[model samples]
Target: MTSATRPQLEPRISSFRQNGMRTDALVLSEPGGKFKYKKITLRDNLLEPDECLVRIKATGICHTDLNFASKDRGQPENFPCVLGHEGAGTVIKVGSWVEDIAVGDEVIVTFTSCAQCRNCETGFPGYCDRWFKYNLGFSRFDGTQTIEDPKSKKPLKGHFFGQSSFAREIIVCETALVVIPAPTPAYELLAPLACGVMTGAGAMLNIVKPQPHQSVCVLGVGSVGLSAIMALKTLARPPRRIIALDILSSRLELAKKYGATHGINTTYQKDLMPTLMEITKGAGVDATIDCVGLPKVVEQIVHGTARRGRIVAVGVGLLTNAVSINTFEAVQAGLVYQGSLQGDSDPKRFLPWLLKMNQQGKFPYDELITTYHVEEVAEAIKDIKEGRTVKAVLLWDTH
Candidate 1:
């Protein structure tokens, strides 16, 4: 073909390694502080041989994000950090050694793990040996930051949960990227599937895996609880009854819309055990999932479980807090209490499965989303705390 007739090729986009870029991010300057909007210059060290740069499209505001932002969770190592884990975006740059994914691929950024660990090798990245260091350590596995403050000229912690995605762009490890189909829905609606939605639904489907016609009581009807309810509906023979307990009547009502057979407004009841027992006909529930990490709530739910019933603690709480349980009573009832992280999900397999279920209308997780521009992140967090939004997604105009 003649040169004139040959198609013109698009110029290759500049990458962080070649030409470092600056972008806007919501920064937390101190512990228990508000996220300040600022333009940050990404450090040249952002990319590693096994990393890739993602242009963030949408990021979910998870309760875990709020907890890290608002409380001194004893992880001072991660303070003054960029906090966000549930991110969905397009890959814009790949390091020299990155082969599994490349530029232009759509992906969900999730928790990172050492693939060689026993748990990860066995399909449980959530329980990776280096879970705390990789996800909550703020920096990369080697303790390095990818972003810096322009004025202070100091490193700002990044790589949170393998992708500090509260910004317009992020540097993430290759393992953290879960590629999704090209024709998927808007990124905003798919972001939560990376964390909150997956955690809740996976806890039920993967970890709990409740038997058919059994009774289940979900404590705290937030995104996680609602997700559990939605997953329950997909079972060939779902639980006999799905009870939702939350202080907010609106959340309880929303729970019903998903699949809850009963709603318990805990605020009106002095004790939750009585109401839960009554709902289970004095036998208590066959399974209880505590989405509220409070010790008191865990105690109540522990007491409300029937003989041989299982209780899964799905909530995150203060590090110093501990739940007091009567060992004798638990043993007598053959009650099982376990803690689940990220719903025991193997994101690669689970995420695609979830997307397929969502496409089939078996999982309507999008119904819980409330979108806001990136600048309105603070307002979105407030709405989440006030029980106004089930899931708040921050949309970035990366276009």
Candidate 2:
């Protein structure tokens, strides 16, 4: 969308306080730079009329974090930005307009959106017209920034996913905070639900909606992929065959533990379509939830689906990337290829449900996580990029 037509957010930064609040944050200094855990200060008074201060207890490392951090140095969201979004924490304070959510309440932080938009009103907040402006602009919608270097007065951009949970403390908008009750679950177990885990589960159950007689395939059996597998298993009449595709054998095995009926290591097996068709016993896959958004992967699977099969893309890829579709094939084969964000989930309602399912042992999302101290950010990044960890949860107490 063009800037002229895009929604312009009103400046929402609160007034300046006599003293700024200081806290720890993993600051990305440049494109391809290492994450440095350091001190950052909130520029203005904490919390707008509809905002709250959250002391981040745990945050998950996601592919989107890596994708944005590797973005060019000159962009608004690049260079000296804070980037974690899958955050779970406690509300330390609330703004005047905030209700239901109070100080000391547990919460999960997720993407924010304009609540009045058509998409939001119609149960698709992830597609809100101002979604990019609010969640990805790296600042308050009105072009104002919330974070800055306390020492050198250096400029830093944050407000990522409305919380920028990479920091120890954050002033988050009410739209991004989903409150949980007392006797809260462990933050490590809840962090990923804010985005990664939630996306997979919601995509499988909410969007894909695989039936008992159908066959489903999940590409990239990482945390998100595994979540989809588990969600599929939760169905009283789940799909007949749940195929898990990944490059790593370990992750494939992990997918099986979460209910994947078949595991295929794509790294070793080059021809995927034939193998998938064979596994489905000559019937193409009925539903495909792509956790990997590579162009080639998408192109190949487009023809491996059954007539009327659904392919849902929930992977976080660069905006510049595009996947070409064969119009005739799509029409003739009765294919449905769609894009999704956060599994089109309303975090306020969906996360609580996921947590409930988790409590019942029906959705063991916590099993995918590998904890790392906030200070060990580098190691976590390395492991995730190298497939050593399905989900890395960073805790605040270490540093």
Please write out the lDDT profile of model 2 over residues 1-399, one tens digit for every residue. 322244434656444444578899999888787899899997537556678888999999988888888744236445689988999898988877677788888989999876777888777889989888889888777767778888777668888887799999988887788888867988998889999999999999889888889999999988899999988656788888999998899998998888888998888877788988899888899989999887787777777889999899998466666778899999999999998889988888889989888888899988888999999999998999888888999999754
Highest TM-score scorer: 2
Range of the 10 consecutive residues with the lowest summed lDDT in candidate 1: 1-10
Please give, for residues 182-295, the per-residue lDDT of candidate 1 as tens digits: 696789877999999999999999977888768998889899989988998778888888999889999999999988999988777757788788888888899888888888
Clashes in model 1: which pairs? none
Cα RMSDs, all models: 7.0, 3.9
Question: Candidate 1 regions off by >4 Å?
Answer: 1-19, 44-46, 74-77
Candidate 2 residue spans exceeding 4 A from truth: 1-17, 44-46, 71-77
> Candidate 1: how many backbone clashes?
0
Q: What TM-score would every model get versus the actual structure? A: 0.93, 0.94
Give residue 17's lDDT in candidate 1 (0 to 100). 45
**Distance from true location, Cα of 17 in model 2, Å:** 7.2
